[model samples]
Target: MKDNLVDNNAYTYYHTVWQNGDVAPGTHYLDVTANDKFEGIVKVYVTRRYDADNDHVKAFAIAGANDGSEFEKVADVELPNAVKAGKAEAEFTIAEGKSYSKLRFTVTSTTLERGYWHMAEFQLRPMTLNADCKNATYPEAFAAITKALEEANKAVGSVSVEDIAALQNAYDEYKKAINPETGIDAIGVETLRNNAVYDLQGRRVQNIGKGVYIVDGKKIVR
Candidate 1:
């Protein structure tokens, strides 16, 4: 279950046993590596069995740091109103334009008698303007892709590769239709017939490559 939490497989979960003696009424920390400064939303998936009245977490706080030593509080998330027997998820949106390389989750208090923690997954997604399909020539296609991505992001359990691939395909189509150079329509360019492609940043490329790329005005993969 510990492996599952870190493996991005949300279907599995980790729990605290009463006998572990690890549960205590003190602050617990989780360190997350973001690699570089970034601004995004953080999501935590946790479960509480109402079998015990003290099964829920009481307070949660998130902090961030650039050097991983000095940290500043980024958010203080509100606890859920009602505690259920099954797993539930919550999202904490980071302020726009704020950058941090390291993130930490500090669980200040818990309801469990032993102070044990139970969690299924944790995720951080970077903020993107694509959610609004701004500057998109093919709004419909872009909107579809955005919807798919949102659904994938909100998924609670294991997410299939096929689901992600389909979303990527939709995004590629929209990228192909919107000329990156102009940020406008792709009327003059015949992307399907043109072999030349460009990366998401508008740099012309000879190959589609593995990452997302723009052909004509549409986004495609090699």
Candidate 2:
């Protein structure tokens, strides 16, 4: 635990490559525990093995468990090579949206050779997504928050708290206007006053205009 492979420092690897050409292959398993529950992980990255002599892992599978039991396979990938000399970085992505507190990776060594696995820093990232507002009752309020997010993303260093507060204030003001829940909706024909009907505007209506109207002490829509 002192030299954690997932520390992101990349100074050392898991260092399982202890066997020679006469040794058997290895299947390495690595796991990370989190203090909080995460929905999913993105950006799966591992530093490729440095030397050419070590038998490395060519493919890996990821699994997750919520209660530290019954792990479910979330994703897997076959690497281009177990070890490379050119670069120390390899990239992969996992898009599983299931909740978990423990994430584990299963790395299998390349076949027909000595078994071992080595990699620099193993990195994974979890993300929180914005709430959906497409079908919200007051969409404009959420739209303002989306606009603020767009502006913040465009200018990374300069974030305006005043802009965010303004958007929040707008949403709060809109909330006040839609209060006093009268839980009544208009439905049915245009008007029903014994063959005569009237709209909310107290006007004589005969056609279906899709407007709220009063009929028999109740609201109705045609």
Candidate 3:
């Protein structure tokens, strides 16, 4: 069940820093539904990709749902060229200041390369902080995140990526303020759901342990 493909169940947050990439294009229309939801713009990131043409988004559309019912078409968006991280983003606003629980969309790549569309990693999000915090485990900490999210979404004129990133940092800081655990912070929880291999000790093990390890969100014992 694990390969160099994007699995809606397994695909999660990845690094934005330039590094050797494992991104590969799918053979079909790339449609994904976010586990969390936010208002404002949506962005995707592709790192270390060799072809630019394969990264183009053909048709982009968004749907939102608050009650987990059928997602109503909220916007037919036009994408903007990414200012950073070989990314592509679409700006959309939810009506009536609604926060959706299901944010679903379809992204078709403009071109196909050797059956690979080079969608790279859809890794752009400063949205994690915007999830409702009223009933959260750490309401006090997440309230700060909510405030940051509010400023970013309601800002006058256009909100820059830097401004959005500041919100993300606030999310990270508040997560720490709440103190989820003694070890790693909750910020890396998304990164944990990836294709990398790790051993029993929680140490990332590479180029070894072909079996008896975890990769692509699956247990391999071959």
Question: Best-fitting candidate, measured by TM-score?
Answer: 1
Q: Using Cα atoms with residue i matched to residue i, what is each candidate's TM-score against the true structure?
A: 0.50, 0.44, 0.40
Judging by lDDT against the true structure, name the best candidate.
1
TM-score of 3: 0.40
Q: After superposition, how far is residue 156 of candidate 3 from its true place, in Å?
A: 30
Candidate 2 residue-wise lDDT, 1-222, digit = tens: 324454333344566535454545436577777677646335555655444355455666678787738988777766555334212333444455567788777765454444455665565544343244221555564456445444533443454566445544653454454342422122123335355555433444544332334565444433
Off by over 4 Å in 1: 8-11, 15-22, 40-58, 79-87, 93-97, 111-116, 128-143, 149-222
lDDT for each candidate structure: 0.56, 0.50, 0.47
For model 3, give the 10-residue run with minimal summed lDDT.
Answer: 1-10
Question: Candidate 2 or 3, higher TM-score?
Answer: 2
Candidate 3, 64-83: lDDT as tens digits: 77764776777765555442
- Candidate 1, residues 1-222, lDDT tens digits: the string is 555454333334556455555666444567677755656665665555434444566666788888736988888765563444344557776677777788877666665533455554444545333344454446676567667656654442555667657766766676566644554334226543465666543445543323445565565433
User: Model 2 misses residue 159 by how many Å?
Assistant: 26
lDDT of 3 at 207: 47
lDDT at residue 26 of model 1 (Cα atoms): 40
